[model samples]
Target: MEGCRNSKDYMMDVAGRVFVLGVGIDNVNLGEALKRIQEYVENGTAGLVVTANPEIVMLARKSPDFKAYLDNALMVTADGIGILIGARLLGRPIKQRVTGIDLTTALFEQAAAKKYKFYFVGAKPGVAEAAAENIRKAYPGIEIIGIQHGYFNDDSKIIDDIKIKKPDILLAALGMGKQEKWIEERVKPAGVPVSIGVGGSFDVFSGEAKRAPKWIQDAGIEWLYRLIRQPSRFWRMLQLPKFLGAIILSRLFSGK
Candidate 1:
């Protein structure tokens, strides 16, 4: 913890941030976000990184506890196209969407080269292990020191394991709210240099799930692709329109 600092302290020293419906998103592209996490790891600073989308923003709006967690995060990258659109509607344009999966993929390369130790937690029983196996095959020399699936009543064991392993980064995939809260309450205090709520990234890495093709992702309709693939997400996708409407109302009232 040589260069350790709290989230507020770290944020004050970083680049610009854009507020989307009271949720602050760091105005950074993928490279910048990666660089920041690398710096955090190198500096021995502990902080939580949040990859936020429209649904997450909406959830934060409804939950004070969740909002506080976002507010205190070291960095919040825009992970949804709706968030990028919302930022522009508010007259504060974001650079790009830095998705959880993309960022995690990018980190594997860095971790491989730099030998950054990683501890993965969350997803179903075999998901994290499967993801770790794929990661080892894909990124040779990357050090994944620990893996724990997100199915436990108590966190003491997990926290204890993380402390003992002393990983540079902790990737928690316990979904949105739970992941963020877990990182803030458990991982950060455990002294991990950097922790991020990776959502379902493990599923993607494990090949249990598939991402949209590059063309679809570039078209900014990855949400639609996901909806088509997982129709159950239809209800979650509704948040995009609700998010847009909220942004419009926020702009109208604030006149920003």
Candidate 2:
């Protein structure tokens, strides 16, 4: 295990960060975030990257351990519309939304060009393989060093395997809190540089789910499109209002 005390100078020049729902999110654009991630990979710096949305933020609020774990991440991008709204309501403007899928794609582009090795974890039995196949078709030269399903009872073996593989990046798609926790507790210590929690991205890349159109994504209402597609998400969608309420409370109490 490389340990988590490694240098974080890669984040020194980050555009800026703002605390919303008590989690510090970087205000950089996607390009800047990708550049920082590349630095981590090239320099062999072990760290975790977080894609924080409303659901993940609420989970963090409910779990002190998770919140503290997030603080230790090398970067936490605003991945949800609620994060942008919360930042604006607090008078802090984030530059853009850096969704996990976008981030993964960006890294894939770089890996293809630079021949950086990648390891993917999470998703159903064959979903990761399917996603990797799709990525190979898209990025011809991208090297996928390893992959594993998320149904394991213990993570010790997976962590050891990642340490042995030493891929430049590890994308974990084990949902929200679980993915982040796995990255922090297992992947990061295994010396994998630029570990990211990409919830359900494999499903999309593997053709199990369809992403909303670019227009919808540009309009920043992909959440609505998702709810329309997966009506079962209706209950989870209720958290948006709760997130907003929490932001309002944060503003009132902090006087920011």
Candidate 3:
């Protein structure tokens, strides 16, 4: 199916208010875009959201426990440019590549313009605060509701504080399955309207991480560059190849 732009489907959540993306297969919905922010503000639960690619989906299929996490996400935006191209190769055209970093940045820019408060949850120690500071410096007058490291036990006290502060936006960086499951489990029921699962965006926003240059991003070779930078990530990123294999294999089976 072609990406359904502006289409919304209410997802299963504590609040039953989540919306899934359709228009741009890779582009997630704004309602789901801001899920994490709303969760901390309303319920103080920070979550992980994954930018799932076909390979990751395949991986999930192999790991039923992990598959459950992926299934629980409020929304899963297709992040890889390859996913878009592969979809085309498979005869399904996805028009755009929506990244977690870009998505969160876009949402924040819009919220800042509207005088909204923001809470950045997740990221390694200090990453969230650095991202919050970077955003504040970039946009003067943006209310940074709060920031917290993504690592914490279920009993973390920041939850209570977040509920009290009530920021309009919350950006979570807990990464993939965990973040998405977090948002779906929280928010809406708590009455917070927006939460964004930002993955490693905190690292990029904080200068602790680096992204591919504009040209690389446009070329869809961002993965190659990341592989060069962090050879260690190679193992995990094998999901890309696995994704391609899944598509090819599926095609073969369908043709039979």
Error of 1 at 252 (Å): 1.0
Residue pairs in steric clash, candidate 2? none
Residues 10-30 of candidate 2 have per-residue lDDT tens digits of 122344777776678898889
Q: What is the C-alpha lDDT of each candidate?
A: 0.87, 0.84, 0.62
Please give the lDDT score at residue 15 for candidate 2: 42
Tens-digit lDDT track of model 1 for 1-256: 2111112211322459787777889999999999999899989999899999999988987899999999898889999999888888777788999999899889998887878999999999999999999999999999999999999889899899998999999999998899999899888999999999999899999999999999999999999999999999998889889888877766665534
Candidate 2 has its poorest 10 consecutive residues by lDDT at 1-10
The TM-score that candidate 3 achieves is 0.75
Candidate 2 regions off by >4 Å? 1-15
Ranking by TM-score: 1, 2, 3
RMSD of each: 6.1, 6.0, 6.9
Once model 1 is optimally superposed onto the true structure by TM-score, how far is the C-alpha of residue 154 displaced, in angstroms? 1.3
Q: Count the backbone clashes (under 3 Å) in each candidate.
A: 0, 0, 18
The C-alpha stretches of model 3 lying farther than 4 A from their native spots are 1-50, 63-74, 187-189
- Give the TM-score (vs. native) of candidate 2: 0.91
Question: Please, what's the RMSD in Å of model 2?
Answer: 6.0
Query: Which prediction has more favorable TM-score, 1 or 2?
Result: 1
